[model samples]
Target: MSARLAPVDMTAFSPGRCARLIVKVGSALLVDPDGQVRRDWLKGLVADIAGRVRAGQQVAVVSSGAIALGARRLKLPKGGRASLEDAQAAAATGQIALSGVWAELLHGEGLTAAQILVTLDDLEDRRRYLNVSATLDRLLKLGVLPVINENDSVATEEIRFGDNDRLAARVASAAGADGVILLSDVDGLYDRNPTTHPDAVMIPVVEKLDARIESMADRGSASGMGSGGMVSKIEAARIATSAGAHLAIATGRIDHPLQALATTGHGTIFVASQGARARKAWLRGGLTAKGTIHIDAGAVEALRQGRSLLSAGATRVEGRFARGDLVVIAGPDGTQLARGLAEYDHVDAHRITGRRSEDLGTILGYAPRSALVHRSHMALL
Candidate 1:
């Protein structure tokens, strides 16, 4: 027989510990029974976001409600299933309204909002992933909050994320967010379906997503307005934890939902597998090495000391590889030291071998990064 897992400690779920956070607001929370946007509730949530920002924590929101809101404005049916064309039309109309509301609310709080629409392809394709990551990074640095959503207007079933739960997880990983809050109709995960089984108990904390834990997830949505259910949230938890972000599933129906999550312990917190260094997670396990860099003994020592790999320390570059390709770092004695994303291509690396950082612009004909592999992007073996 297996030993019982420890009960969740509600006091540990503090937002103050997180430097960056992503919150996913569901359609059910954003739209009411009459298919109207919950303006007052949204204002409350925005105020919570403002509080987080004032505390020096960067925050992003992944929101869903465009289709439902659009359906209402277009005089279409409110609750039933919608066709693909109907969804596309609703998204086109709803996206405008969604952006306007977010802008108005955020501006009122002395914050700027940037609208970002993406599909799964944007996160899956490496080039596009880099572009999106850079854009989000810049926005955060400029003290802007990004309002991201699926490109429902143009996305087909094949390319769609299907729901915002997994999209929020992907965004958390890409943005290097330390935490994710999934605001939903339900409070948190439970051992059984609470609505059907009156004796069901809420699970406040989950340290791992084992087989038994996964089995607790239900199939269909409890909230009639959304597509994702508890099962999708579980999947999102898996993705978020693996990417080194803690995930919290909480009730969005309450006023000031984010504030409630922080103070009331009103959610299930899924602890990350480790710390919030997603790039290191990717470097350690997510990618395959495309090439190798042979470095001197001095460079090996520097890397072991948690320093970046510089071109001056590189003795040789092997194999044809492009920028951002994962490469193995080999010591002079032919022992592999680490794996990391290459900042320059094989040709550029070969050209700059044994060169100093100040000479990189002259050698490469452009201002270049100071390191061949930034320490943040490297995983020492």
Candidate 2:
């Protein structure tokens, strides 16, 4: 039988309806002028995030403001020019408070916040990159919202010398996310500086990145306390769109910024031309799947409805495949239904083929990251 391709409709680029999304918030919006956390504004943002979660969209947050909050707590300078050591010190001090605040805010909305810290080098390394991808995939599948941050405490570049824009883009790429919202001080990319020139015009959407688009950042477009400025955001857009993730530059200075962007479409959105699977280089390689998961009728129906292949509905596991290996998904009738990256190895998979996700922790003696196969990682045949 031949397999047909269905549109990962969102992978073509709509932030509002994307299957997986990453929202990047900057320090200026998260931290007050006096270096305190903006709890009220965050509450509204959490509400927005919770709404997205309820809608079945897996959302991750890449947040800033750790250093600013730390500086205030430690009585550091507010000039935004601290040395690397001081910055690292501040990051260490602030991360504790930042995690606490995020946990508190996310919990209010009945969401669990998992903190993930990384450096640019972590993503650049192939092995580390794959680990990040797997971890993110599991977290999203489990309904745990990830709050990513640059590991500034021991890093030489991030926070001390770079911005979260690029980091957020990298995170989006690794997570195979369809959209990224960089909530900053400005509403969107402009023809010129919006703060300095009232006559400046905002660029509603960017379909392509060209020399002209690059030039916009050169025309005095940086407008906030965070370091990346418009240049880094443009660089971020390049990285994100290249990875088939659309990126948005929008103002987060107001309350419920994500809601505003969603309802009013008040931002510059950079559209992606392809999806993470458009490359399909591996699938095209025709490597045989290492194993097969024979799912029950219920799971087959669920998969067809765009749901994941859960262990609860899997009747059998065949072949010998390791975790992260490509595996075939078959129906109870033994017909191939799809293929996807496995969340578990054959040994572990066989041990709990028909177990419930909630019972996975006790069965495996550890928390499970995902079901048998996540919808985002699966390709129906």
For model 2, name the residue pairs that clash.
none
Worst 10 residues of 1 by lDDT: 1-10
> How do the residues 161-278 of candidate 1 rate in per-residue lDDT, one tens digit apiece?
9899999999987787888999998778889888798777778889989999999999887777888999999999999999888899988878998887777676789988876554
Model 2, 37-142: lDDT tens digits are 8899999999999999999999999988888778777887742337877778888988889989999999999999999999877887644665798889889999
Candidate 1, residue 309: Cα displacement in angstroms equals: 5.2
* Full-model lDDT for every candidate: 0.86, 0.80
Model 1: how far is 145 from its true place, Å?
Answer: 1.3
Q: Against the hidden reference, what TM-scores do the models get?
A: 0.86, 0.72
Candidate 2 minimal-lDDT segment of 10 residues: 1-10
